[model samples]
Structure formats: C-alpha cells, structure tokens
Target: MIILYNLVLLVMRAGYNIAALFHNKARAFVTGRKDVFTKLGDYFRQNHAKVVWVHCASLGEFEQGRPLIESIKKEYPQTKILLTFFSPSGYEVRKNYDQADFIGYLPWDSAANAERFISIVKPTLAVFVKYEFWHHYAKALKQHQIPLLSVSSIFREEQMFFKPYGGFYRGILKNFSYFFVQNETSLHLLKSIGIDACAVAGDTRFDRVYAIVKQGGEIPVARQFKSDQKTFVVGSCWPEDFEVLTPLINENRIKFIIAPHEITETFMAAMESSLQVKSVRFSQAAGKPLEDYQVLIIDNIGMLSRLYRYGEFAFIGGAYGKGLHNILEAACYGVPIFFGNKDYEKYQEAVDLINRGGAFEVRDYTDLKAKYEMLNSPETFLLACEVTRLYVEENLGATEKIMHYCRTLLA
Candidate 1:
C-alpha cells in the first residue's frame, strides 16, 4: 500500500510540474530553487544537528508557524532554518522573509523524491505546520529516526487521519514527537487515531497575534480613514462574504476598509460599485493622500493583518468560503471579530470567541445589522473587546511552552 502510494505520488509530481508552468506561482517555485529538492539528499548528508526543517503548505500555515519558528530560531540561533513550501502563494509573498536560512519548494511527496529531499536537507528535526501531512515524507522521516512535530494542528472530521479507514495516515501521526494542537477537540480527534503525544498549545497563532499587536501594531501606512469615529475594517474579504452585508456597509453608518481576498481588478471594481460611500482604491492611493476617504479599498496584499490596528473592529475574510482568515490577528488587539459561518471546523479560535461573546458570526444582512447595532452600543462593543483582550492575555504563552520542551530535548 505504501509503495503504491509512493508510485502514485511520483506520477503526480510530473503532472504537477507541468501544471506549475501555467500558474505563475508554481512557475516561481521552479525558478526560485532550481535545484532545491534536487539537491536535498546531498545537503542532508552534509548537515545533521545544524539543520531544522519547517514545512508550510502556504502563507497561512507560515503565519501560524511564525511564532514557533521565531522561538526555535531564538532558542537555537546557530541552528540553520530550512523552510519549504508546497504552494506558490506562500513562496511568492514571503520568499524573502529574513528568518529562514533557506526558502524553497518541496518536490512532490513521492517515495524516491521524499527520501532524496530528506537526505539532502538533513534536518535534525522536522516541523510540519497546521495539518499538512505528506505520507511519504512522514514515513521517510520516521525511517531515518528524525524527530517530527506538528505545530498549530487543527483537525476537522473530514481529514483522512480521523476517518474510519484512516489507519494508514495514523501511522504517520505516530512518527511525530508531539502534536501541538489548537484546541481540545483536535486533541480528541488525534486520540481517536490512537495518537497520544498531544498538547492543547492553544494555537501558536495566539502568540503570533499577541506579539504582532504589542510590536507597534501595523507599521506606519502614512494615511488614515476619513472617519471621526465608528470605522470598520473588512479584512480578507470575498464578494460572497459581502453579498448581504455590503448594503449596510454602504448605508454610511460606518466607514470601511474592504480588503478583498483576490487582488484582481475585476473584484476591486465590483467592490467599488457595491459601496455607496466614496470608495477609494488602494492602488490608486499610491500617489494621493488617503485622509479624506471614508471607504478605502486595500487592493494590495500583506496589509490586512496590519490594517486591523486602524479599525474599531474587523470582519475577517474566508468564512463565506471553505474557511476564514486568522481571527486571532484582529483579536490580538482586542478587536471584535465578525465572520461568515463556513470555516467553523478549521477556526477553533473563532468558535471559542463566539461562544465567549467576544466575536459574532453573520449569516446575512440581518445578522450584520444586528451585529452592527450591537457595535453601536459602546458598552457592548467594549465588553466584546474586553473579552477579546482577556482571551489574548490568557493564552499568550505558547512560545514558552514549545521553548521549554525544546530546552529539555536539545539539552
């Protein structure tokens, strides 16, 4: 079965490479590290304890693992960081982030490719962020007696590891030295697979968000919204997400910062048409002063998380789709959160805050209006912000937890 899986992955790699040519992102990977996975085995052979491998499927996972990676770097400054991506989205956006010693793509998870890649990187420890489990890579790491750890792991029922016939991937779970999950539900899900080395680290993201907030929240963007008061930031947005709520946003009761999910021109134009307020485009604002606009459209990427600092509350994007953006990013500043309903299983933090009344979910315009009305009540908004602040203060120590464990292990 494993060999068959390996063969299947091998066939997929060739197809994926061909597929990469059509996608600028995938094309970037081939260009970014022409010899990355190709030279992995050789690199691994040369470096043993000096290397630590961190794998993220894309930018979201990269942010989830950022604090943990920073902690690891601080704890072991001399240890080199080997970061790998399986997607172009993450690689293209953050390929130049200074933390990693090396940034590149992982060849497909075929047996020969996985083994060869592992042999070259020669990671003393491999950290897989979120729930990205590559079967052959898991097996290869275990076969070589390398330590594997999963950080910020959130398990949904649909994942193969939790299915009734998931024993195959459960074997992969056993290779990990630890499973640092986001919540108790994920812990239970892992236990369902008979995987016990788990801890409710409460999402390394809380640590990341907390640090981001305290670290001078959002660099100077050189402009402000034309709001005297009551400004709302709609972050990581999709049109379906704004379908019912755009009317209220256009109602002029509040200001807006709609950072659409896609940076395409079509989406930006559609967003501008949806708003009644004088909507200003972010790209167009490059040469103009931004102080007079009530509605600012952030057409660029990398600014959503930072932009939260300028708002009273921010509606995170992704809930209208399969999932949502990181609520903790806004929550770190005690910013009240509102989102659509779909990312419930993946967003454990959202569920927790919603239950705690720190956040709310909107199904349509009515829900948005209700949440908006509540926000109008300064007392209610303050209470929500209080809940968010307390939640952040209480869970800001995940970095210490991982660091403590690493101290004992690396000693």
Candidate 2:
C-alpha cells in the first residue's frame, strides 16, 4: 500500500508538470516548489527559534487552522511559526501572511523529503489541519518524538481508514498524538477503528467567522449599492452557479453583489452579458453612483467575506460543480443561505444548516425561485436568520479547546 501510494504521488507529480504547460494553477504548483528545501533550510538556519509548524492542504483548511495559528502566536510570542501548504491557492494568497515566521510549500510526500523537512524545520509541535494526513510526514514526525496534532478533523465511515484492506492507512492515523475532531460521529468513527487519542472539538472555522464579524471592515461600494434595499450576495460563483442564477438576477427585484470565484476578464464579461439589468464592476464603480446599478460585480478577491455584512441573503457557489465555498462566512452574519443541491454532504455545517432551516439547497432555477419566495416571508426569513446566528455562536470555542491541548504540548 505504501509503495502504491508513493507510485501514485510520483505519477501525480509528472501529470502536474505536464499540465503546467497550459494551466495557470498547475504552473504555480510546479514552479512554487522549485527550491522549497533550499528556502526552508535558509530560513530555519538563520533563525534557531522554537518553531511550531502548521500544515494546510488549501485555503479552506487554512481557515479551519487559522484561529489556532493566531492563538499560538498571541500566547507564545517568542515561538516562531512555520506554515506550509500543498496547494498553490493557499500559498499564493497567504505568502505574505505576517503572523507566520516562515511560509513555504510542503515538499511532496516522500520518505526522503519528509526526513529532510523534519530535520530542517525541527518544529517543536506540528499541526495538520482538517484533511491533511501525509503518510511519510506523520511517520517522520513520530520518529523525531515531536507532538503532531490533527485539528478540526472529521472522519466518515467510507474513508479508507475504516475499510477492510486499510491497515496501512489506519497506521497513519496512529502516528498522530491527538485528534481534535469536529463532531461525535468523527469521534465514534475513530474509536471504532481502534484510534482513541481523539475528542470532539467542533470546528475552528466558527471561531474564525465570529472573529471576522467582530472586527468589521468597510466596503463603501457594497454599502452604497445595498443602501435602502434588500441585497442578495452571490459569493464564489462559478459558471454553473450563474446558469441557475441569471434568470433570478434579471428579475431585478432586489440589489445583487456577485463575487465570482475566478475574477478573470472573460468570465466577468460573460457574467455581465448574462444579466439584463444595469450592472457595474467593482473596479469601475469609483466615482459612479453605485445605487444606480442593480448589480455590483466584485472584480477582485479578498472582499467576499467582508461583503457578507451588507447582505440580507446569500447564495454560496461551487456545490453545483466541485465543492462548496465557505458558507459560514455569510451564515455568521445571520443571513439566510442557499446553494446548489449537490456535493455538500462532506461539509457537516451545510448539512446541519439545511436540517435546522438556516440554509436551503436548490436543484435548479425553479427550485431556487420557490425556496427564495418561501424565505421572503418576514417571519420565515427572521427565523432562519436567528438559526444561523445561534448556530455560529454555539459552535464557538473549538479553537480554544484545541489550544488548551497545544499549550500542554508546547509547555
């Protein structure tokens, strides 16, 4: 199984290199790791400080781990932090994150790379967020007697660890010193598999979103566009999302703030063409009367999370195609949420929200229209708002729980 896994990784590396010829993100993934070891060695050698390393697979996992990272920095100001990502999306966006003392891409998961990386960084404590379960890295950390924690993790019965021929994968779980999982199902699943160093800590993303709500930021364009009217926020929208939403947007009953996942010129132009209502790009909104446009298209990144503050309702994208974007960002603002009815079961929050009536899942344009009308009722909308708010508040403190365990390890 180990050999097979290594072979698969090698094949993936080759495929990514080939895909880099035409794919921007693939190019980034390939080029970003060109001198990763040299960069890691240079930084670590210059600073012989006690380091805590946090590894996140992508941006989503980074959000789940961010509260813990910030908490560690605040509590142990002298301890240096090393943050690594496997995906370019995570590293590229957060490369200049000031909190982490060092940021780099994690070398591909191989025994030699793992041994070399563990020796170079010498992290006193290593934290893997959410779905990061690198086999060789976990083994290397255990051999070095370092405390490795898996935080905000969730397990399902269908995962390889619970399969009949999953002995090797189950061994990887044993390498972790402790697991701070998201729910009772995950806790019970681990115990069933004979892995007991775990507890239900909920999800750290709740803490992250709550913090965002408190430290409010200003977006004058979004505020002006939303003034004196109900606004629907469409965050992380892809073409699939737009296919179902274009009709509703054309109706122009309320204001809209559409922030697409990819802010490419072509996609933005297409999106604008699809809408019959008057619209303006965020970049082009300067000096123009924002209230004059029915649609305000965000032509940049980093503002979608904060834009939720100006929304009465939200439709998060990605479930129609791949995975869903972070719905909690809008939910924390007490906004009624909606999304495509696919690829969402893995996200426990989405499932919980649907069950609690805090969120709705629509199959297509008709489904979306019906659900929207149902929620339009004042009593129903207000109830959903309260549900979402309370859900976020109740899930608070996962980061603190995980931090208590981290304190013991760092001490």
Candidate 3:
C-alpha cells in the first residue's frame, strides 16, 4: 500500500505539472514548492529552536488549528512554531503570518520527502488539523518517537478507514498518539474500528471564533458602510449564492455587504450589474458618505470574519456548491444564518444552529424571501440571536481541552 501510495503521488505530481500550464492555481501549487526544502533547511539551520509542527490542509483547517497554535505559543514561548500547508490557499494567505516561526508548503507525501521533512524540522510535537492523514508523514514522525496528534477530527462510517477492505488506510490512524475529534459520533466510530486512542474535543473553530467575538468591535469602514442599518452580510458568496440573493436584495430594504469568495473583476462587475440599488466597492468607498449606497461590495480578502460584526443577519456561501464555509464566524456575533439547503451535513455547527432555530436553509429565492420576512420580525430575530449566542457560548474551550492533553504529553 505504501508503494502504491508513492506511485499515486508521482502521478498526481505529474498531473499537476501538466495542469500548471493552463491553470493559475495549479501553477501556484507547483511553483510554491519549487525550493521548499532548501528554504526550510536554511531556516532550520539558522535557528536551533525547539519546534512544534502544525500542518493544515487549507485556510479553513488553518482557522480550526489557529487557537491551539496560539495556546501552545503562550504556554511555551521559547518553542518555535513550524506551520505547513498542503493547499495554496492556506499558504498564500498565511505565508507571512507572524504567529508561526516558519511557514511553508508541505512537500509531496512520499516516504523520502516525509523522512527528510521530519529530519529537518525535528519537531518535538507534530499536530495535523482535521482531515489531513498522510501515511508517510505519520510513519516518519512515529519512527522518530515524536508525539503526533490529530485535532478537531471528524469521522463517518462511510469513510475508507471504516470500510471492510480498509486495513491499509486504517493503519494510518494507529500512528497518532491521540485523536481529538469533534463529536461523539466520531469517537464511537473510532471505538468501533478498535482505535481507542481518541477523545471528543469539540471543534477548535468555536474557540477561535469566540475569541474573535470578545476582541471584535468597530471596524471603522464596516461601521461606516453599515450606517447603523440592519445589515445583511453575504460572506464567501458564489454566483449560485447570488442567484437566490439577487431577488431578495431587489425586493427588500435591507443594506448589504457582499464578500465574494473570489474577487475577480468579472465577478465584481457581475455583482454590480445584478443589484438595482446603488452600490460601491469597498476599496473606493472611502471619503464618500457610505449611507448613499445600499450595497457595499468587499473587493478583497481577510476581513470577512470581522465584517460579520456589522451585520444583523448573514448568508454564508458554499453550502449550495461544494460545502459550507465557516458559519461559526457569523454565529459568534449572535446573528441568524441563512445558506443554501445542500451540504449542511458536513458542518455540525450548521446542523446544530438549524436545530436551535438560529439558522435556516433556503432552497431558492422564494424560500429565502420567506425566511427573511420571518426573521425580520423583532421578536423572531431576537430569539434567533439569543439561540446563536448560546450555541457559541456552549462550544467554547475545545482549544483549552486539547491543550491540556498536549501539555501532559509534552511534559
């Protein structure tokens, strides 16, 4: 299976190389790793600091792992943090993040690469955030006697590890010193698979988002744009999200701030054309009285989490498409959430919020309009707000729980 995995990695590398010619993201994936080992080696050689290596699959996983990273740094101030990302999205956005002592792309998951990476980093402890299970990396860390942990993990029965012919994949699960899963279902799944080195740790994203809420207030630009109106924040929106939202925007009197997942010029132009109300791009909204425009379009990234503070209600995108984006970011602000009906199962918080009546799924414009009307009522809105606030409050401390176990293991 290891040999087969190596072969698969080779094929994937080749395929990505070919795709790089025509696709910008593929190009970035290839180009970003061109001198990754050399860079990592130079950095490690210059600094003999004890390292805690944290690997994330992408931006979302990075957010899930962030609270733990901050906790570890606080507890062990002298220890250097090494963060690695498998996806360009995470590395590109957080490459210069000050929290991690070193940040780089994770090399391909071949045995040789994993062995070399482990040797160079010499991590005292290694952490993989949710859904990142590289067989060679786990094996290399184990062989080095380094503590390896998987945090905020979620497992379902349908996954290969629980399958009848999944022994090879299941072997990877044994490499972890411990697993901090998100729910009881995952704990039960691991137990059924005879892997008892696990415990329920809830989701670290709650800790991260909740922390954001406590520290969050007053983004001058966002506040000015909102003009104290009942704002509707559409975060990480796609074209599909706009299909349902466009009609609602036209029919309603609510103010809007749209932060599309992609900020391509074409998409921004399309958004401007879709709305009948006066709208202005965030970058250009400076100096002008923001009250003049009904819609404020965020044309950049990194502010969507903070932007939620300006909203009374939010529609998080991606539920209608691939999967849901972080609904927790908005929920932390005690705002009711609306998203498309599909793919909500993958996000436990979304399901929980829906059950608590703080979130609602819309199939189309009709459903969206109806929910909008219902939530617009002062009593209904306040009830939704209170439910969301309680949900976020209940989910706190996952980071502290995971950190407690980690300190014991490290000690």
What lDDT is reached at residue 182 by model 2? 96
Runs of candidate 1 with Cα error greater than 4 angstroms are 17-34, 41-49, 217-228, 241-243, 262-275, 278-293, 298-302, 321-323, 342-345
Q: Count the backbone clashes (under 3 Å) in each candidate.
A: 7, 0, 0
Which pairs of residues collide in model 1? 40-120, 41-119, 41-120, 43-120, 44-120, 44-122, 318-323
Estimate TM-scores for all models: 0.84, 0.90, 0.89
Badly placed stretches (over 4 Å) of model 3 are: 45-47, 220-229, 263-293, 299-302, 376-379, 409-411
Better of 2 and 3 by lDDT: 2
lDDT of each: 0.78, 0.93, 0.91
- lDDT over C-alpha atoms for residue 111 of model 3: 81
User: Ten residues in a row with the worst lDDT in model 1?
Assistant: 218-227
lDDT of 3 by residue, 134-230 (tens): 9999999999999999999999999999999999899999999999999999999999989998999899999988777777666787898788688
Report the lDDT of model 3 for residue 97: 86
Question: lDDT tens string, model 1, 210-249?
Answer: 7766775443432355335667888778888878668887
What's model 3's lDDT at 282?
A: 89
